[model samples]
Target: MKLNKTLSLAVVAGAMMVYSCGGSGSKTETTTSTPAPAPAKEMTPEEKHKDNPDFVNGLALVKQSDCPSCHMVDRKIVGPSYGDVSEKYEITDENVERLASHVINGNVGVWGEIPMPAHPALSKEDAELMVKYVLLLKK
Candidate 1:
């Protein structure tokens, strides 16, 4: 009787240990990919447009121009976020021109090791519009 009681207690303790350690018979070491950094602020639909008429129009142009295929409004995709780009430049005529030029001719080294493809089809006016739209995301 004593030996049987000791064996039973050992079995119960062993089972408790196993249960405490997570009783999933097989260990699954799952590693999830770390997502890119999120934007610092919450965005309302109104925040996207603000008071800029050009940016409002250019927001539509951004979709038509296939910008979202690489860039998102907030987070990183293949390219940096529009918010990230907005953070890169200050509001000024010269900065706008530079951004427009980059959109038309394509720029390398600004983003990362990968180069941005040249948007030859994008007109100068449209490029300016897109730049303005991107810059509007700052606030």
Candidate 2:
């Protein structure tokens, strides 16, 4: 009787261990995160923001502002990274104006249907500065 009970308990324990552990031949889960499309490199502190006062302002504002909630300076999050934007658009003065408008007005088609929300809190000048900092990341 003692041997039978020990054998039963061992079988139960073995079964529990097998059940608790992953089933055999389990497939690994794929990461849901999408990688950045561009082969953009991370820039140095001096190079990333550039020396523009506006760039500096953007670097500071980005941290305090809602920018970091979805965007990274060099990598993509919910939105494209500044590097990818720089690679896409010309860094001309006209573009600066246009992008600032884009930033303030909030466009959807450029990056995707995800839609960048408008920044009513950001002044035009601040938008321009942020755009400058982003443009500086152009590869």
Candidate 3:
């Protein structure tokens, strides 16, 4: 009787240990819940204009070139910011042509003592596109 009781208790304890440790041969699935992410912020005017054909093409041109090395959208780097340029110059045929020429032939003493390097490799059309994109960054 004593031996039987001891064996029963050991069996129960062993079963409990296995059950508590999840060591049973059967597999169990567990799911965890997480909170949903917040909604995306609204895009600014310039950001919204990104989908425009001219903006897209011009942005691509700027990215392909070394424009970022000296200029940025909102803040000045080696040169004035694109936003500043946009604010300084209005969108007009004359302004676009003049700026495109400046981009291709380079300009000095316009922004400051620092000179804008010429991108002679860029065609007039491509340069105008880039200028238009820069101008579109106006706040």
Candidate 4:
């Protein structure tokens, strides 16, 4: 009777271990077989900007830089919102030129006394994209 009880306990313990290990191993296999879904795609540059080369270009330029750390499309932050600037200078070539220059050089007094830091390394073409995008917002 004593030997039979001991054998029964060992069998139960071995079965528990096998079950636990099997459960965990199957979970790992399921995870390996199933990949997470991909993220949603952003709107195309041309569709979003709609033939406004400057805005499209500007978006690319801004993304390349650290500007979004402080600026947003519709709301205030450390700087004027992109929408406000767009509205302020819509339909004006001069505004495009001026704003583009400001991006490369940075601006003070326009948003406030808190001056934007200059990025002189940013090219004229890249700056123009920002200006164009802002202008589109005006519409």
Candidate 5:
């Protein structure tokens, strides 16, 4: 009887240890964490105008023309920057065409006492392309 009681007490103690301390038969807990979101992408001139052939043509045209001699993309040089022109006007089809006309016809007193010379040689289509490119140069 004494031996059976001792064995029963030992079994109870072992079962208690297993229950309290989480033995091999017990299930292990798991956790999952969410990751941070990716940052937003900034658009470049190339990216913004990638779908338009005119934008590509205008980029090439500006390089060939004396447009760079007077104007710059970001800041003022001789004439206003492309960015400044973009800021002054809303970029509609009408504004683009009008600005293109101005590019070909040239103007004075609008920007300053300094005059913008006419590009009589450039085609209307090409001028419009150039204007489109310029308008996209906004900050």
Candidate 6:
């Protein structure tokens, strides 16, 4: 009787140990929470204007042309800076038309003796868009 009782207790304890350890081929799942994402950085003036159709199209036009070879946004290089041009000319319809004409037909004695080369290949509409982009660079 004593031997049987001891064997029974041992079997019950082994069963309890296996059950506690999840050894019955059952999967146990544990959940962990993920951290939230950080806030977005503030956009600059140029970035803020990215939504504007003229700004986006004009910037793309300028990038695809030789404008960067002579012109820049803030400082003068071979020609006047875009910011300087922007400050010198107001954002008027007449100014846009005049600047676009100058871009396509070329201009002399404007910024200096260095004449702005004519982009005869550029369409008037595209030239106007480019001018609009430059005019937006005002400090």
Candidate with more favorable, higher lDDT: 1 or 3: 3
- The local distance difference test score of model 5 is 0.87
| Model number with the top TM-score | 5
List ranges where model 3 is wrong by over 4 Å.
1-42
Model 3 lDDT, residue 120, Cα? 96
Error of 1 at 125 (Å): 0.6
Question: Least lDDT summed over 10 consecutive residues: which range in candidate 3?
Answer: 42-51
Clashing pairs in 3: none
Runs of candidate 2 exceeding 4 Å displacement: 1-50
Cα lDDT of model 2 overall?
Answer: 0.82
- Scored against the true structure, residue 17 in model 4 reaches a CA lDDT of 94
lDDT of 6 by residue, 1-139 (tens): 9999999999999999998888787877799988888888877648878888888899999999999999998889989999899999998999999999999999988889999999999999999999999998765
lDDT for each candidate structure: 0.86, 0.82, 0.92, 0.77, 0.87, 0.91
lDDT of 3 by residue, 1-139 (tens): 9999999999999999998888776978789989899899877755789678878899999999999999988899999999999999998989999999999999999999999999999999999999999888777
Clashing residue pairs in candidate 4 are: 55-132, 55-133, 58-129, 58-130
The TM-score, computed over Cα atoms with residue i paired to residue i, of candidate 1 is 0.64
lDDT of 4 by residue, 1-139 (tens): 9999999999999989988778546554534466778888777534766666666666777877888987888898999887787677765778777887988898899878989889898888777777676667653
Predicted candidate 1 versus true structure: per-residue lDDT over 1-139, tens digit per residue: 9999999999999999998897767876679998989878877645756676887888879988878899998899988999999888987889999989988888888898777889998898888988888887786
Q: How should the candidates be ordered by lDDT, best one leading?
A: 3, 6, 5, 1, 2, 4
Better of 5 and 6 by TM-score: 5
Please, what is the TM-score per model?
0.64, 0.63, 0.67, 0.60, 0.69, 0.67
Please identify which of the two predictions, 3 or 5, would achieve the higher lDDT against the true structure: 3
RMSD in order of candidates = 12.5, 16.2, 9.2, 11.6, 5.3, 9.4
- Of 1 and 4, the candidate ranking higher by TM-score: 1
